[model samples]
Target: MDLGKSQRVTRSEIDHILTNRRWSLFDVSVLPSFDTGSDHRLIRASISLNKKNFERDTHRPAPHKIPTFKSADLEPAIESNTWTLFEDLTEDYDHLVGAPLKCADASRHSQPTTIPTLNDRAFAFLEKRKAVKLDPNAKHLEKVITG
Candidate 1:
């Protein structure tokens, strides 16, 4: 069919569009041309359902649950005044979130690497990185560090 004509497109069509393919949608005119010579037609399709389903299928994270450790779970050891157990458990949690850089010999590495720690500051830094791009001239870094 002609490029100007409209048709009911599917998720596959939208995908094609996203992948840089041309999409032909039906014209919005109340009356469609009966002449076959014309290259366009008045087509109707529901984007709401397609958009909603696409978002529902692709928007969220993969189905997975992270393990959790509660401080109260260590109450027995704490009651026994076993600080060692507490420290060990704390270290385990740290390792679970991120690998130990010292163990990785970070100083000996040629490339600079950032170890994300489970803390408010680390989270805020990540948020800033996502929201802003780093400038090569260091203008953005200067504003951030000084502010």
Candidate 2:
């Protein structure tokens, strides 16, 4: 064992003996000529032990509660007596539904012309029906008119 170039050190047989049964030495090395300000040379060893002997915390925190609302809670406002039906409200029907005849007067230089095509009238009627069907307030208006 070359302990160092300047100083030599030795270990006894009793120093090499293992005291504990759980601990086992894996490696042993001698560090020489490293200036640590001490005359004695440094020796290092790797050891292994069983980790299953230790205890650990496995508990988890509880989940938080959140508030939610149902459609039934909103039904009172929809069915209220004060709710105004959209059809009962005053609105210019001819102006709201686009009349091609009305556009003839809008131009000063052009002569007033009427839409003679039955196909154009049918298309306008279909468009108005689709608009009424898609309107959310139209349901309440229909209920007031029919009943």
Instruction: Return the top candidate by TM-score.
Output: 2
What is the lDDT of every predicted structure here? 0.43, 0.48
Where model 2 places Cα greater than 4 Å from the true spot, the runs are 1-18, 51-147
TM for every model, in the order presented, reads: 0.19, 0.20
How would you encode candidate 2's per-residue C-alpha lDDT over 26-132 as one tens digit per residue? 67765563543345565567766545532222334444433233445334433442333356335445433433233322322432254345787787876777777
Candidate 1's error at 34, in angstroms? 4.4
Best by lDDT: 2
